[model samples]
Target chain A: MKKKNICITLMFSLVLGLCACSQESDSDRPERSETEVRKEEVFGEGEKIKLRGVYLNGDEVQNDIMDNYIKKNWTERFPDVEIEWEGTGDLTNLLKTYSATGDLPDIWYSDAASATAIINAGNQLNLADHITEDHFIDHYVNPEALYYSDGGIYAVSSGIDAFYTPAIYYNKKIFEQYELTEPETYDELIQVCQTLIDDGITPISIVGTTGWSVRNFLFFTILMNDDPKAAQALLSNEIDFSDERVVNALKKIEDMLNMGCFPEGVANIDFSTHMALYAEGKTAMIATMSWGYPELETAQDTGVFMWPSSNPQVKTGQVLQIWGSSLNGWAVNSRSENRDLAVQVAEYCTEQEAFRHAAQGSSLNFKTENPAEVTSELEKERMAIYNNAEQYIKTLHLNAMDSAVAAEFATYTNLLLAGDYTAEQFVKDFNPIWKENTWFEK
Target chain B: MNKFYTKKGKLLFALPGLLLFSVFVIYPMIPQILISFQSHNGAEALGYVGWNNYTNLFQSNVFGKVHRNTYFIVGCSLLIALPVSLLLALLLERASAGVRTVFKFGALFPSVLSVTVIGKMWAGIYDADWGMLNSILRGIGMEQLTRSWLTNADTVVPCIAAAFLWQYIGLNCILFYAGIKAIPEQYYEAAIIDGAGFWRASICITIPLLQDIIKYVVIISTLGSMGMYAHILVMTAGGPGDASRSVLYQMYYKAFSMSQFGEGCAIAVIFIIECIIVSIIINKCIAKEPIQY
Candidate 1:
């Protein structure tokens, strides 16, 4: 009994001690409120300012842009400002960790969701007043798109990415041998797939492991079938996922699956595997984003085609979906002593990134023109699709969704692709996720 | 010196470990449990939510699937690992010294490699298009048997278990082998005198003596499976659509990925309770007697 009493006392003391340590105090956090509109402050020429930055440099392309281009130029412009840039694999969790510990960096790279999360935690500095005319001028994507419902700009993009457009990249040699032209409608696509399948070749290959490709396919299909407003309405929770437009789009994907458009066991195919399959000529076509152009450069004679409308009345070019989100870029830490300098660095990086996008000739939403001739044929074809688009629908779902809904969106879409859920089942299962996570003000 | 054995002195010796465990393990659990009953947005707690988080978790469709996946993999690893390890240990016990050395190294090799390397290697083997498994299937005229092993919802959990079992099977064998070596040769000799073959002797003598070690392995294996997250992350990222998510992966996804820290903490709390219950059940069911050998 004495021993039990002693043990209880010890445990109680431990709990009590931990409670004191774990309870967060507002006094511990730096006091800053709302999006502060500040005059442009000049930095002292001789004064040493050191800024720490965190960014996602996991991808080689992003790494090259940051290290060789952005950081390089920033050093040339602000030689006195010492910037320590740390590359992180998982930026969201890292920033969250920093936010909880009250040690957030001067500036960090952010996506829409991460920025929203940090802003809600009151750890991010809003840059609404810090913007210059250069941020809005000659930009295909209006800077207004970056504004939160509260009218605060938290994150700013460098430029628009070719990641906006989803296209079916086909092997030209195979298509030429089969005497098949690019399919202009949904029925025509199915017939082309059938012809490819008949010749003992897989019609398409997609990275099914990550679910993004499959989700893009479904979203683009929806864009082809429904009005741009209806698509936006679905994302804004104005309509249920069980709505006819979404259901019909899911059915079309299911039809593609049933028609053997995708290879057997496609779900196991990852990015590398699908690329290999496409490069090896095992699949006649691959459905992926225009950002995949760099990776597909080595492939033999590839051609690009936009997703055709399933409804014959809806012209293919009448509405085009662009997966552009302004919520991805640099954000300033609210509590930083060097907040102004950090914002300057972030702004510089954003501008340089825009310049790089223009150089690549794939800046879909940015009005920045390519300085040189567009050399890559596939890029040219992607340009043609962009040029032909009558209406450009920004993919608001990517920016508006909370993390939970985004994850479930991928899961349900991947399940649909795997044939584990029928179109009706996908709609029924996904409606709640849509409703639960759709909290953004329209 | 005499004072060192006293209760006060003994407690002094244990203080460091106690403090370390409390700081690293027990201390975090308190806030974690607290967070489980609050609405957390990853970085900060919003307010008290009572049992709402738990109710939400139980009501979630993915929750049941993830739990089922965890149980299936745990069950699979135990069922497949135990007998194979036992058999391997028994076989190695009678083998020549050089062969034993070679086999032992071969068995332990997978365990020595990092989980990332093992995961990637197996992913390559299970690759649908050009993986060795499919290649072999096609080569052997068993082309119909080829599958995207890690992606198929029906086969993903088992495949993950197989990868896990492959890594640990050798370690289990080495453990059993050590236990077999410790057993007195006199028992085997007596069994031989009783007109028993090697298999019969092993069934009677080796099996009974191994209860303690077997219980230890079972506990670790069960707990290990309960906490598995890396292989799933590396191989599938908990997809082919949440079909292969383990309980721990669900916890991670809920907290870090979904930013539902309260739900994540709820899952963690339940996971801790589950591990405790399983340990108790295992303790009661096996190694009833402390072998005096």
Candidate 2:
């Protein structure tokens, strides 16, 4: 019996050993054909199609808009296709896992990196062919952002949330009490923080542990001096991350940390508390993008300022601006049996009718040239910021760099925030990650 | 012929489960090993690049720190949880029926609670300001002892281990309690009659008799420590500059976050080997031969 058990175990082990010599081929990555991508619009007008879509769950508004507002409109246009929406955690990891395992959900929402990885894997449908010049994609408020131009389009998004861009949402009442003017220079911003600090108040409520929150402060420095064009270049080694521009950005954030602008144990405070601290008037300011809206809304006297012109890319009036929004879009899985139908589904989901409804109850600025009609005064203020900017730069750096590098950026930045690394040491420590990166889309 | 037919009938009943075990469990092991050697980019398989993934895994800057963290958590389980669990079981074994019932309820409380709830609860407890832990420390005027428990690199892993131990110690206690109960009461009664004290009876008789369960618990604890990812993920998100990450968290980070699937699988393989080795060592140390009652 013992011998038999040993033999049984040995047999499984041997099988495992043999199977270890793998014959698995590259998944769906055949060599590209010489022809330009087939762009024929394959409209699904018949009963044989089941369109599968992966959507962000818990956004009941977006969900209602998709299920009722958009679905009814879409089916009226193309009657026979059955729409099945799959909801998942709003996680990029979920999409990435599906892509990795050759189980790309038929239609999935994707961020730039997720789409880029899929595109680079040669698994996404070429969207450019089917999307006409007259398509809703052309009307995106920021058409430049509708698709990443890698010689072809691969994804389509409903709209962009321009309001999510980083700004210091300050308590106007507190500023009035303290007689603090909105800062127009990095030094002045520090002075603002210092004046607030001297009055026995936390100068800023920033969530350090939640993510690389310092990146926004640093980006202000970068956008102030340089055009936001080198994100890809820096990753591809065309421009070094150790450049003076990059180092200066790092110093800008480091300076804030050194000045004790953020609260003690800032690294431990989560985003909710960070926002709450500001909402409750415990902090003088919050360095946040529009995602802090609900929190920003509660503080009835909150005023906003762009991170005081760090280096000013343009004259102060025409400073380059960004509205941080979801880098998500709809893409068709190339391996899907219903690839053609999936493309139609992507279009149906992101088209004008859908974009209009999805943008409803959302303060996000869309890429459409035909803007969603703004009813809220707050949205108009957001749009005025969007309108006044010379350049609407997207913060794609997080998605542009290797995920590992981005994570390390956050890690090292947290170290600076946590007092483990001084500004110079932060720069010194950053050089290694910059030197050894493997994931670059360029 | 009838016996053989009956045996075959038993095999037929187990076939579906056996097939599932083969396909879902045994089969995935081979590919998991195979994928470790391949250059999988999470985007697609980039073809085989034998040992390249392992080399990259070794090259990861955080690998050593993560390795140390994993082992430290395992050590915490061994040194702290095991002893506490055994102690609880011993106390429960000797307690009166009502006291035993109360102890059982207390012992199993954390076990039934979700790890997510436990992790989040402990996270709030360990919060630097207004947390139960810091508040108590402040209330006692040991304010210097209070710090951001989850944010400090020195304290993050230990704090997580404490929470993890909170869940696991109870579980192991229940396991040990059951094992102690299974020890025929006659042996304890006879030992007492011979003037053996409780400690002597426990040390000389009860403990030896519980070796079978001890072996099982040790193996489970070792494997549990090896694969512990969720609690740390929920509590820390592997932060304080990734200082609190275990090997499993790193594996997930590498594959999903960095798209380094092959390297992640390599970590998985190395983790599997570590688990197997630990299990073997524990089995050897705990019970070579079963002690018949």
TM-score of chain B of each: 0.94, 0.92
Give the clashing residue pairs of candidate 1, or none. A140-A367, A164-A323
lDDT of 2 by residue, B1-293 (tens): 56656755666566557655765666677777988999876777789999998987787768889999989988898888998899889988888999988878887898899888998799889887568999999999999898877878888899998999889898899899999988888998899899999789989998898888888888888789878899987887787778899999999888877777888899989988887788778878888987776
- What is the RMSD, in Å, between candidate 1 and the native fold over all Cα? 4.1
Q: What DockQ does candidate 2 have relative to the true complex?
A: 0.41
| Cα error of candidate 2 at position A277, Å | 2.8
For candidate 1, give the lDDT.
0.78
Q: CA lDDT of B39 in candidate 1? A: 91
Chain A TM-score for each candidate, in the given order? 0.85, 0.79
lDDT of 1 at A326: 59
In candidate 1, stretches whose alpha carbon ends up further than 4 angstroms from where it belongs are A1-50, A73-75, A78-81, A100-103, A132-141, A361-373, B127-151, B182-197, B200-212
DockQ for every model comes to: 0.53, 0.41
For candidate 2, lDDT tens digit of each residue in A1-442? 5455445655765576456544435565443221113122243333335567787664555566566656668768756656677777645777777776666778877665566667778777777766763364554565555555456666676555444566677888999999998887767888988998898989988887735566544444344534455543453467665677666666766667778898766776666678888988889888776546555766657777666655455443244435432446678777666666677677767764345544554533234344457655554565567567675555544434566666677777666666656667876777787666654445
